[model samples]
Target: MESGVKKLKKGEREFAITAGVFFVGLIIFLLAGWTVLPRLSYAEKVQPVEFRHAFHGEDVGITCDTCHFFYKDGSWAGIPKMEICVDCHVYLLGQSPEEKKFVHEYVLKNRHVKWGLYFRQPECVSFSHSSHVRMAKVACETCHGPQGLSKKPTEYRTNRITKYSFVVYGAEAPSNNYGGLKKEKSVWGTIRMDECADCHRSRGKSTACFLCHK
Candidate 1:
């Protein structure tokens, strides 16, 4: 009778250990599904843009501020107006005939260039441009990556299915990452939460949930 009781307890212990392992594995599988998989939007499909940033940034020596102008303050002067390009044609720097035709037809004719923004702050975010640009005196290249180096205009490719646009970096969606790199000058990258965290932490400011989410 004593031996049988001991044997029953040992079997129960083995069964309990097996159950614990199974439970732990199940929890890990669910966690991965929640964090890693959804990091990418399912709606997004890859779009191909022929323009290469490495060629422009390294070879052409174009500064990022040419397009992304920043004032003396910390606030950024958002997208450039058409007036900036009134004097310059896309063909200014070794542009091909195709570029000339496109520019003459669209930008020259007063049609707006429809470059999609990848890094968009939420409307509710209430970000001030003057503070970050004029007050903070942040560099244009600090947030917006350099673009002046490209010899020709980049081809615009949008994923109709995912509604995401791709540049040299990955999708230019607000939620999309600023490529995996740390600095703006790093090879094509996305903006990630870590970047925001670093900025806020370094400044000793609290980026409250209310400050970011709508």
Candidate 2:
């Protein structure tokens, strides 16, 4: 009986040691996570031109539609061509180095700025900007976030799992109960099919798959 009692104590000590080690390891993992994990998860790329929408929209009073125009055939403009820039930037408008580079390289050469688009829906999806913009009168900020107020170009984050630009998910807030952008300031950061379904259902719009998918 004494030997059995001793073995029981030994087993308990071993178990306690194992539990303590595991707890310590977990704490270490969590501590390292604060700094290390984010770097591992995110990929970064620098944009060629550091464009400021705030300078254009807020300061210059340029509207979103001025640059992202919609066509008569219902397609929304992607990127403004060099000709559009030449209309205003034929001469150096600002003393900024970027403006000078823009005038010298792109404007003078009549070359288009290769702006990288953040939201690139899958080929199966066919989004209509005209229907959303003209008919529904949805503001550009609803989906694109407050990019108009953004002072600097932000580095786009791409989710490794979804393979979609994190901007699509991160840019827009979650749907409010009344079918508009979230006002409570929560960034759930994903525009999934379910989110779209919820928005459509809230607005009493048809949630037909064919409406989104080609």
- Count of backbone clashes for each model? 27, 0
RMSD of each: 8.1, 6.0
lDDT of 2 by residue, 5-78 (tens): 45546788999899999999999998778656644565544456777777888888887777779788988877
The most accurate candidate by TM-score is 2
Worst window of 10 by summed lDDT in candidate 2? 173-182
Best prediction by lDDT: 2
Which segments of candidate 2 are over 4 A away from where they belong? 1-8, 31-35, 167-190
Error of 1 at 145 (Å): 4.2
The 0-to-1 C-alpha lDDT of every candidate, in the order given, reads 0.52, 0.67
Per-residue lDDT of 197 in model 1: 66
